[model samples]
Target: MKSPKASSVTIALILLLITGWLLWSSAAAAEETPYIRGAALIDTHGCLACHSGNLMGAMKVPPLRGCELPEEEFQAWVLYGCPQAQPGRAQQSRFGMPAYEGHLDPEDVQDILAWSQIAGHEVPDQAALSDLARGEQVALKAGCFDCHGPLGQGGIKNTGSFTGAIPGFSGEQFKHLCDDGDPAAIEEWIRHGTSERFLSGEPLAGLGRSFMSSQLTKMPAYQDILSDEEIELLVRYCLHINSLGPMSAERYEAHRAALASSKMEVTGQEDSLAGPSLPREVAELFSSKCIRCHGPKKQKSDYRMDTAAAAFQSGDIADFLEVSVIQPGAPRESLLYQFVSATEEDSLNEVFPMPPSEDERLSPEELKVIRDWIASGAPWSDKQTLQSAYSD
Candidate 1:
């Protein structure tokens, strides 16, 4: 009954509506996990990146245990720097948080205040602190920032190197330094000053090796200076900062602009890994033992390891870096392997183990299977295998 032009217009409108809804739903569903609470943000965002201390109010990190600031003032001081806080800047010191304004939302501020009322008064359990927080202390004590720069923002010039600078933990400079794929390379740097992976690999290393060897500021081996535990902490810290993307407001807006005009569909398993077909045994193991938390629907930290990709992912990192759940060929470099292997320790260093429930914890034998599977290459099983696993 409608004219052709009228029908065409209606169809266009319907398509527009559909696109908008998909975009909205995708945005909403994308962040399946809860936001970090205000208190954790301190550790997660490395509020201590600039200042070192507690909420009880020190010079910069501050010590605000029992004391309370008005909401508006608190928000102003945090979201916007307090001009009054900057007195005299020492040569090696900084005042106020990083240049991140508008990254946090209103709910985040409210959450922070609420937490201070309850938990802020008590001395924080060092063991309870996030690895990122703990790693900050370790780096400070060991004087890593001297070379790496504050918060591992390495910008110190190194003559003869390809990039001509010591690489920071995150960003293009770091990717330029190494493959940026495996954290083991990070560990190797800490243990031996230079990793084999970095020296042997291409694009930079092969061409840059002569320059790297001739550089004025060479990384010193910490084998004697640091204990094994301290070494692990340092690696975690480096990886933590390396991954904490510090997405600025401007860049995110540009991302939004691109998204607004793009034809990208936000399917449910947006973060799903794409790789080799998953084997039946692995699929069965994941469906039975892991999928409840790291499944297709509800993922903690956006890590849905049980998706058809179902390769591996133990947990999230500094809240910004995007790490694939598993690296197919390397078990030692895989967080999934490390978490499963170290679950027995439940130590301060280890992340909360996969399948956090004590009763549901994987057996040693099961862990061995995971290790072997990872070492062999973490392949995702087929849909039939997944269906069969679920059936059992």
Candidate 2:
């Protein structure tokens, strides 16, 4: 009813407002899409708990700060755990990823995928070729960091019924193992895997084959898993770390001296009716079963049971031992006892039982030793012996 110019202006203004609203709505949706959905999915599924450095038994959970994986592979891993995608691949930690097959909906999987891609993309790609940097990248991609730590500083990896302390690459022992300047021996060891004990002239002993074969997680054969180039990179990385000087050189030397001075003394006679004193027996038990993860090189959960002082003073270890790990005069209430006694079925819905893997669980006799040790006040008398043994 108004003039044509006035009507046209009103129509144009309406169109402009509508267009602005649509554009703003689209932008808002785009901004919120990936991160919002992905973060929610990750949180709800408890992915952060494992990936963000929570201890699952003795294993040090690799930080997921810079995780990168193919979309389909990531999805499969999240939904089915490790066995489905890589059948014989060693589990990442004592408590490996739980299969979210029935738990996560299809949309939930998609959201998780979106989150992984977004989070991964946020981290800059490693492009440096320096020995240290390149070596780290190689180790990270090869899953060495899962057991060896992000900096190759060493950690623990379950090997059969016991745990093995992975030596830090930057240590004198590791340097000696690598044959100083030559990395060929290390390369060969990687290529052939653990089957052949010696590589070139270097002895590649220590990892017990019988024990390895009996466990669900074993050192993987790089010949099958990694390319020649990858192995070479790892060797180079090890060499570079060795060149950087040993971690705590002074401490290492002092420890070496102590070991040299200490005389080999038997704890108890072979046929002694009374088992070794609680301290000696517990020391042996810890050395054989616990030190790998809680020793000097790797202190998963900041708990170190290798030495008396470390066990009693490192982080909350003392409290945990007193309360959860060892309850004086009450083995049944002890979390350590409970964990060791847990069956495969008990761990299905939650984290896997202590030692985590079925094959690595303590034997009935071993369990009894632990129970008796706890019931007897968990005394720690032979501190000097443990300190001397674990000096390295």
Model 2, range 1-392, lDDT digits (tens) per residue? 69999999999999999998787455322122333455667878778877766576555555544345555666567666753454435345324777777677556766665444434432113643343344456677877756553344454444443234454565554555456546776776567654342333433234344444565555566887877767876886666445433322222222222222222212335533432235455667677666666676787667666655555453453353455555444556556567678887865633236665677678888888777666544555442434324445
Q: What is the C-alpha lDDT profile of model 1 across 84-176, one tens digit per residue?
A: 232233122234454234566656655555434323333124553444455666777777766765455455567765445566564655554
For each candidate, what TM-score against the reference? 0.36, 0.29
lDDT measured at residue 378 in model 1 versus the true structure, 0 to 100: 50
| Clash pairs, model 2 backbone | none
TM-score of 2: 0.29
The lDDT of each candidate is 0.54, 0.54
Count clashing residue pairs in model 2.
0
State the weakest 10-residue window (summed lDDT) of model 1: 27-36
Q: So what's the TM-score on candidate 1?
A: 0.36
